[model samples]
Target: MSKRLIVVFFLLLLLQPYPFVWSAEQVSALSKQPIKTVVTDRFETGVVLTKKVLLPNGDLYWMKRLEFTSDHREPYTFSIPLSGSNGTFRYVERLPAGNRWATIPVDTKLPQPSGFLQTNQMSMLLNASNFYIKNVQGTFEQQPNPLPINVIRTLDGYKIHVHFPQKKNSIAEIWGLESKESLVDWSSTPDLEAIWLAIDLQEHSKWSWDGYYVRSPQTYTPYSPNMFWRLPANYAAHSFIITGGSRAADDLGWVMLDTILPNQNREGYWETLPRSEWLWKDYGIGAGFFDTRFNTDIATLLLKGYRRYGDRHFYQAAEKYSYYLLAHIDHHHYTNYGESEGWLPADYSWKQPHKKTHVSLNHHLHEMNFLYEMYLETKQEFYKEMADKLLYGVKNTKSMWIKPNHDLHYAYLPNGKMGLQDYPFLTYNDLVESQSLFVKIYGRMDPDLAELMANKKQWMDQTGVKGYRFFPL
Candidate 1:
């Protein structure tokens, strides 16, 4: 071959993807076989691999190694979502030796005493554990954090660069535990838990922490910065503490309430933000428009916090927000089309009702749930009456049903049009809670709500456990 041709061939060979596998003496806790490394597939951006290990006991376990073989011109921003059995999955990180395993027992009201190490130590595990990684191996380092790391920015933002570097053929690993036998009910929806868990991991992944929240950098892709302040995030919280709760969840939930109480405005509200609909843009009102959605959401979560921790402060804060929700309705009905009477706006102004604004489906659901809870707590028929009115609006005015997928509409606009589909699990969760409240209050399920829940469940099963959004190339 010509020398020039030989040089070109060498470049092509070097750029081509290479897969790596390593066998470790590490025994799988479950399969009890020597843990084996498995390489999966390669995408345009990076290669993906599943490093399977025996779960300490013979239970099923999957270890995933995320890394790359190409040199990026700049720091690479990486995010790959997984679709799991629309059921129960636990994301447990392997810790260093002498600090291997500890668990928060299910249903324990108090946090487990931290004798071994805090769950946060799992972060350290990413930097140090390399049993699953390929080209780049890691040494198990203990608590004081022995690895010297750097920080760099990708398209996502600046992160604690584990030096999970953008070097040729580097690897980093993160472990996740999936349980299909436990029969988690949402059998087919995307495994958002695993998706979110991947943020902290750096199987050649970047750990970006913006200045705003040291621990919480821009973890999500830009378009999907889903409702940092616009809507309720109960589902995100759900992913955090399922069944057997954790110390992290307990602490985070408590701190959230504590922070909100002091920061709430005198009118029993936080600074209002806009709504999201089409393509992650604020198609609703701009900022400073106080949406009733926020009040209802805060109130509902506070009520939950009160129930969980018996905090009077939580109840007090929730009650204030509850009052705010009822008081802020847009009585003028500018976009009034369907059962417009007693319906709320997508957002409202403190000075006057937000006329000409759109109607929100999530508002109806959240407001209904919040008001019903108020009635239960305070024994006020007024709360039930308002909640019933909102329920009536949904049942009579809106055609939220998506028969094939069983999804609900996102927003009801002035032109009698509904645009966008509700997040796969959000509305379903709302309907279930609302139905339970309806049953508790009136001793019977609301027929419409029951149907909605049933349909939502079906949709969830069909969609299964896969991340909803795909980052555009």
Candidate 2:
């Protein structure tokens, strides 16, 4: 062959797509074998098998590596999946060492001995004083009262473990913090029994200091730099916590509701930015525009509040938000694609022409869930019809579902674009989340949908960021 032709041939070979195995049977077989130095078809952007060790107990540890080959980072912002039957998941920088692990529990029902009403496992970390120990350890003998805590790395965040003397009532505060630089000396214990009895309660039991709700240590605050002003979303979330049952839930619940009522706009939508208008204005997004995501979240809280207090007002507020969402549905594509415009601008009345609409499968699913719940409560056909339409659109969209084999199918997106040429390369977690949502909402509706659901679940069980066991591509 000519030298030029040989070069062309080698380039053709290099251009071959990543040869991922796309079947459960094949992946399961490969997983049982010993590790290899180099994994076959190991795409740089995908999971690469580095080593597999077989323990004496017959358990295998597959050390797979994932350095995302592409630049898309949004969906792959890593999170440890909820394992077993527990309804708990956490955001960790890395996976845990053992399969048997438990997330540090958060109890909204119990008040901190002296901190704030809106305190959780995370919020308590704001004040170092909340980190107290009953029985001091020898190693921490030289350490100060707010001792250096031992923070264990988990899939999402730190699992703090303060070593107690192993006695029935002995305890040490601040096992460790992820960032030691932020540690401060905190020394106050209002109710020592309550604080020591429940290790999970991090924030001490003092309602709002001055005016601002005490912020949780785990709360992501980049969006709103100021922790002082309580946004509607935060207020609603804090209110939802107290509805469960606590000695202070009744008083705190009324306080949250009273604070939330006045924020409602003239059209009944709640304004989230009485204090942080410039925070959003920088994005060309208007200040008073109500967010569907926040409203949906708050609506659920209101529904819970209604259930807890048996108040007609809570029910009415939830229904009001639901109606606002229904009215904002993108009428343009309601028939064409069965999609509802997911977001609206602050000055939508005047800025409608300039605002470019947005929608995604996940958003649609979330809205459908809210609408379905409303339909159940009101027995309204309108909400049911809306939910059914979204389900039907997802099921019928040819571009959305990809079935590689009889037992394996998953979903992806060209991000809902038209006339896309390349096969969409997307995140494994996104597929799991969206496809699982599809299965959850529509699995029982039809046999065909149920089969698709089963396939996706099977695929998800085997799929991971380290390496997808079986992928279509």
Candidate 3:
């Protein structure tokens, strides 16, 4: 066949109907003797056996697999052998009160078939004496006491029902017999609610740290010892919400806030103290300063916590950090730093000063946006004014806007012309972080801007880009 025709044929085959297998005599016998009562260890029992009913074209006809199980503590095994070309079934072990069962798949296409066939050649050992006898081809043996059985046929398989006494409350096991040496092992007992409850209890217990919330799996180290300030912020926020804003929750928040505030302030620009020998020797970044991406997240979280809780201590700490960010703002009209403008080269270490003063827009936007929220939540005029100036400054600067590209929506560049020479991917996490700050800021001043951001959010979701990590560098 030509390549295109071959492809089309394969596509058509993919769309073809599934095969079905069943016997008309077996169906008639099942319909006549609807149910069977068997003397077994269990007070109540039910069995369903299913086989595929196929059409001449090798496509499936509607059917369901037979299901069988007992609710008693009797060690029993059952098996059904397929005398025809295609046959499959499943056995189940059910719980006491509910309709939940543990299932096992049984396919009669195993390599060996001698052990599966019965000695009498009339019955399949469902479980010792409890047998489903095919007296002849496609015909079941007539019983003195015919049982009421429910047979349901569906697109995938068939369901045959065999009923037992309903008074017994014990659990049972089920097995599918292929032969003496081969059987489908399936066993189960019901405790559904208790299982879920136990899991939930264990999860909560592991997630809790001395009545204060940690994400999951209890840890020895406190939240503050984790290095990054964002940890404490998230822990505090989540704990408070989980506890429904209780006093104890508020206290934990305060404790974490108190612990993180000092470190944040030390990292801020206002701290004029000399660098510790270790700080300079190890980090190589100037005295006790937090200029990393982590610092920005920490600051944002702190500000958010303060806004939500209305704590004076948190507000004061936020104010100190805000002041630090403000001090570093370049107030120049054209270029923030003249010909020395543009992004700081990736190779350029913060420890050694370069001629250019390229600031990451992500950091700048986040800090300014957070400060703006603080202003709105607290009605601080200075914050509002500072935020406006920062926004205006960013809009006029050519260094801040990135050029469009195939690899990324926009790229942060040291110089506008270079256009993502270093990094090329637009990551979902980065976009969410940036957009979150943008929404928070715009929501306060311009609702229209926030709405536009919301529309962009739809695009992010529809393209399935919100969760993917797409960074090229």
Candidate 4:
């Protein structure tokens, strides 16, 4: 062969895609074993895996991971033993993307006795001076109290150790053990034990919504050059809109936004700014207008708030925004696509050639459903008509349903591809949302279609993605 021809051949070979290869030993082990062990210590109880199975495509995967707990009731630890003789395998910890695990010190020493006194209960005792106590234990023959002292539990019952704050002169006193049975008699106890337990847990639980820590410099932020008023105002707006007055959600959202928004506004939106030196200057202008997403969220919040509180002001605001969205629908594609047919460009930038094409079917469906509900509330013919058209367009659009495989149903790509072999990969969130939209629309229109969608949603739910927007009503 000529030297030039040989060089061209080498170039061609380099350009070709490399096929995935598996070792013969690995394949044989995977086929014969049909099981692999996975151990997870996420929950209070640890999980154990014991079996691995080979897929039809020869991909090795796990079949079942049996869970054997050390403590059956509480489940603190679990263990699993595999029987099959498989070759040496490497263990991989599946940490969430972009997050790193850090090792922290563990305190193993037992707490001191004086530190075990309950502060809140002690305060109440100090204030009252006269309180009835139930003594389940028979250890103390003579009851020491101002008025009433009742004992009900064994002396050596399971003792709970508690730590008290350090003080100059803090006194610790031991009371008779209170039996769980004594809590059944409400007349004698006045306060329900379950209610008190819940209250105690609420006071002590580590699960709290104190807000996001703003010190993390790597987080995303929406604004730059912190203006004190702007930060708090933006935080309040985001909190109220996203959380719907839930104090915890509101606080967390606010804190997270505070930390991330500054960096996000400066760095994140730099590409989308009008006077940017970036290759795509027009991209910035398009992004500035993309604030419509926030408007959409605000409209939703207003509508929900109005529904909950019957506030006419909120209703009026929602009505105005709903009309604005309805007015923007392209009437030309109404027959083919529906009210939302040609709305929302395929890409973030409006200048792109793929801009006007269909993007997220799920987002389109959600917009349709939202408009439909608004139509119902206002009895607007335009809103109603748009909702109906969008629903019809979505159902009939073959491009919207890309059958990637026999088991997989994917959203359409810009080039009408079936696989994720295109830009802007479809996610589980998109699929679930689309399914939910279909369920919502069909449930009201056709019960059979609704049922089928619901089953599909259940299957999606089993994939381990929780808090899916769609749940059976």
Candidate number achieving the greatest TM-score relative to the actual structure: 1
Q: Return the TM-score for candidate 1, rounded to 2 decimals.
A: 0.48
Q: Pick the candidate with the highest lDDT.
A: 1
Model 3 Cα lDDT, one tens digit per residue, 1-473: 12453344335335533112224653443333212122223213554333222222222211112223434443223332233222333222233674232322333222111112222112122321122222211112211212232334434433333332222222112222223221212222244223222221111121111111222111211112211111223443444433322222333343345445554444352221223233345334443234424444555656655544544455556555555454444221123443323212121124244233234544445555665676665554556555655554444443334333222223333454333332222333443443454556554333322332343444556555443432221
TM-score of candidate 4 against the unseen true structure: 0.37
Clashes (backbone N, CA, C under 3 Å), per candidate, total: 22, 24, 35, 24
TM-score of each: 0.48, 0.41, 0.36, 0.37
Residue 10, model 3: Cα distance from true site in angstroms:
76
Q: For candidate 2, write residues 1-473 as lDDT tens digits.
A: 12453344234335633112235554453344322133434442443233333322232222223333343322221221111121222211123562221233332211112222111122222222221111111010111233232334455444433221222221122111111111111233334323222322222222221112333222222232222223345442344354223322333443345336545555546654432233333323343445555566567667666555444556667766665665555332333343431221121211223233334433455566666766666555566666566556555553344456323222122234422221122223333434444455455334434544455555555553243423221
Ranking by TM-score: 1, 2, 4, 3
Whole-model alpha-carbon lDDT for candidate 3? 0.35
Tens digit of lDDT per residue, candidate 1, span 54-79?
A: 33223233444556667665544333
TM-score of 3: 0.36
Lowest summed lDDT across 10 adjacent residues in model 2 is found at: 134-143
The lowest-lDDT stretch of 10 consecutive residues in candidate 1 is 207-216
Q: Residue 308 CA error for candidate 2 (Å)? A: 2.9
What's the lDDT for candidate 4? 0.32
Once superposed on the true structure, which residue ranges of model 2 sit more than 4 Å away at CA? 1-230, 235-258, 274-284, 330-353, 401-443, 446-473
